[model samples]
Target chain A: MTTDDPSFSPPSFVPFERLCLIGLGLIGSSLGHATRRAGAAREIIGVDRHQPNGQKALEIGFIDTLAPDLETAVTGADLVILATPVGAFDAIGKAIGPHLSPGAIVSDVGSVKGVALDVLTPHLPAHIHLLPAHPVAGTENSGPEAGFASLFDGRWSILTPPEGSDPDALSRLTAFWEQLGATVEIMTAAHHDLVLAITSHIPHLIAYNIVGTAADLETVTKSEVIKFSAGGFRDFTRIAASDPDMWRDIFLSNKDAVLEMLGRFSEDLSVLQRAIRDGDGATLHDLFSRTRAIRREIIEAGQDAAAADFGRRPPSRADDSKF
Target chain B: MTTDDPSFSPPSFVPFERLCLIGLGLIGSSLGHATRRAGAAREIIGVDRHQPNGQKALEIGFIDTLAPDLETAVTGADLVILATPVGAFDAIGKAIGPHLSPGAIVSDVGSVKGVALDVLTPHLPAHIHLLPAHPVAGTENSGPEAGFASLFDGRWSILTPPEGSDPDALSRLTAFWEQLGATVEIMTAAHHDLVLAITSHIPHLIAYNIVGTAADLETVTKSEVIKFSAGGFRDFTRIAASDPDMWRDIFLSNKDAVLEMLGRFSEDLSVLQRAIRDGDGATLHDLFSRTRAIRREIIEAGQDAAAADFGRRPPSRADDSKF
Candidate 1:
């Protein structure tokens, strides 16, 4: 069902009778909205450790009901998604394991898939299907208020099912993500972690590190950094502003792959540092030119907008009020 | 004058009799458009090593005429602005030094201010005032076609005048930048380089390095890198795609400050790498949380839009046609 097809209707295919989201932050709340819009489930249940977030999701009209606890949330649900920080997965897996209904498909929207499998698989029942999926889309903001139904539109959702997993559960989860406007890809949990290490995790780590470096500089004041940020610093700050707890968990959970990529990044950076110090314009120019091709491919793949400045509407007094 | 004030008029204050823009690329063409709109100069003469670019700038109506050479462009002009890659400034300064009218305020829109002063100071006659400035604003896209009048609106224009410079020339250049909708700040060229090294130069170098590392990975194919880029990697690519020649010049010209900042960045990154390797979530979380405040401050200072994803409009089938 292509998103552009006018005759397409989501109510015809309800994969799960009830869908329970265990966290109501940006990704969780967005899932709630998209799930409801796609009619992938007959009922949507939202649960958050912070009660107000669940209340906000309910008021937003995406979730039909709010669950008080994880055990209660998983009870009677055919599909239960763990959507909190990856660090919380181990304890959460144990807490909700006994309460998950038989034949339930357990998945997550976590950034790191390898860790999800390691922490969650031992706790879940053999009868339950554990499918770890990551939707590679998000904003810098957090909480229920930061979500919208279109968050996953045209984004990639990778599902990593362990060996000997049920085929029916795999297709069912794939269908759910596709209905919510994501293109799905299946890969091994190990490969997912490796791929994401370079594409997502390392980039975020660099952004955070650079922002920290700028702030700590005795020569350059924080105010100067902020004032002159448009020269390129401001872009890094956006990703740096992402949920601290969520990112902290991602780094710790995907430790090996993150470290490997970080090492490579550092090595590459050292080369650049040497080139700059020696005034090697030829080396710097070639690298900078080659990188531009990747940006073009991403735009052509419909992964990002081709417009300048990410198509941000230029700020004006009139435009400020609209925001 | 505030950008929001409807009563503001441009023709009331003309700062220069003839505005000679010595390079018809993005910044040069943009200066032409902005200067015309502000009525800050009586005429705009554009000169480019690439003749087609100068012709295009004239056709776009941002420039009143196209000059055949650097010497010809600065002849009889009261205001001469250099807008090419910083590396070209030395030769261009020498070429135009003989032709510039006495009492002309010669300035540039180069990113590196110290290099501008260092290279251009000895070539020009003392009768001509030399002022270097940098408008901390740009898009990744380059060339004359990418130029727009609003490029500098609400952005900071930093002016670095050498000691014993003419006050009238300084004030005139200041007024010209202000009329073009920039908030102007005066600083020493050395200080400007140091401030920009952390805030701008290091961020760009890091971006370039990360993109290069991602491209060179054997395990992760370039296709995978592009597909999953929206996760965080794509943002780095945008800045990495910036004009290679321009960036190469920036790194080479500002080598001392860039290397200084790169050293600190490497040191800071080592600490983060250690934290990740040891699974120290607390250290990671503390740094991540602190960086978010800087993003908030940038938005508050109007250096960037507060909207998520840099206020990029979400791509849809309908929006694709609009682009």
Candidate 2:
């Protein structure tokens, strides 16, 4: 409580002379909104290869200034955020290398941090700080318009800093995100990539794969599958609806970790299959009982707002605004 | 088209002078709502061993009457609906056998219809009609109050009748479900059980297994799992939250078909796992692409309403009229 009082008393955030956000897609736009709302920067600017997205970010008040090109955006900007798909990071980094302000902090919101750091660092100037980040929160929706101020509220935003990093940049970035109502965790790039492989990347891949397979079945069979999706399949559809370019780059970049976790999941799944095949009701019952206990923990952790029982309604959409 | 008429005629719903529901759980309660909405029966009485459930159903207006004993509920009813746990069919069958009204059209909403027929038919009066059924729609919820008028709207209700079943009873039951906006499919009991085992039962069992593993991890690891469950884990929770007794009965009753489907699923999953471990991007891409196509067919079938994409709107508290 004593530490928190000073943290809130002054009501000020990390101050930056200039901030740049490259590629104003959903993540980029959200960064612009949070940075602007927190007063973390004197000026916030966004640049996108696509002319309309840059113009739209300006029109939507997500950024104070719009840069028509990459070099123009990073010039003299003290803090730069790259929010493009991972496949574009190397090129964007290379394009802005000569223009980055000396001692400027450069960060990204790519799903895979190891590949991102490896690709972006070689092309960047030595004087700049390159910190990789991934905010593990987003709806399946995409684009600049989908970004909202509260998108990161109560979520986790992980920062993967290279060894011997500048403490000033690290703490500043942490405070900036904390202002946006997100908890900040610091880890190494390699570990961040691995943790996310199980937590986010593999889950997304499995969902996409299942939805894709269901969509490909024989016409009659496919129809029945979708019709009865309420039976369980529809849950996969929302995740599958995620931005294709972002996911494609994620799978392409995080191949190793995702593959490893997928292997474990499959092995575990097979053991379950064997038990079911053997008419092992004891196994199924035991597992089902254990999983319900997890539901209780999730409820207790406030991750699941609803009570453990589905019989009780979750906080409903009395007002769509809550969503 | 000829079934439509210019005259103002109400829909033809099968009517029962007397109706009895043997269980008052989710499926049974939903059936009660459907019948009441269509005026399908003059007096609908419930027979659950838990007398509180019978009283609750009556209090909620989900049933027209309450019967403390099973014999009382079935003795004079023209239509008796067995909605007990699938594993309990034989015991229920024996208890109700001598009390079943002559020429009554008896049916069930058990997930495994073949087992139900085998267990119950020997005990039923030969003169009574036995038409087993499985409604392919449900929330991960249980009990009488979990039902609503729209529960079965646009869902499939499969009727699995044995050989030499009475045609008149078939037409009447079909008409009854159709009034609730469901399309009916008639299949042999064996085929129906196999279909459900693959499409529904196996998937549910897998969900239970995975969630259980996640739950049993270290407390820190498990909490992390829930917080980031926007990944695949949250989807599994909905399935795992299903009623314990009902799922237990399903696993025990449909042992054969569930095992067979589990075998095929395990083989398919292993192949995918190998592709992932081998970093076979092309294989992953192919399977994922195939699944997405299946989702397309499901959409085209008009079986899945688009609103389901957001997930039943989390139910409403403003509407507690059922209580």
- B-chain TM-scores per prediction: 0.93, 0.90
lDDT of 1 by residue, A123-185 (tens): 998999999999988999999999889898877789898998876787788889989988777
Candidate 2 global lDDT = 0.71
Candidate 2 lDDT over B1-323, as tens digits, reads: 01122552334555888889999988788888888887878888887888778878988888878887888889899989998888778888898899988999888888788898899889998899999977777877778878776676666788877888877787787777777656667778887776676567766776776666555444226656765665456767777877777787787788787766665655566666676566565766666555545544444454343332233232232221211
Q: Pick the candidate with the highest TM-score.
A: 1
Native-referenced TM-scores of chain A, all candidate models: 0.93, 0.89
The CAPRI-style docking tier of model 1 reads: medium
lDDT for each candidate structure: 0.87, 0.71
Superposed on all Cα atoms, the candidates' RMSDs to the truth, in angstroms, are 4.6, 6.3
Q: How large is the interface RMSD of each prediction?
A: 3.8, 7.8
Per-residue lDDT value at B65 in model 1: 80
Clashes of each: 0, 14
How many clashing residue pairs, candidate 2?
Answer: 14
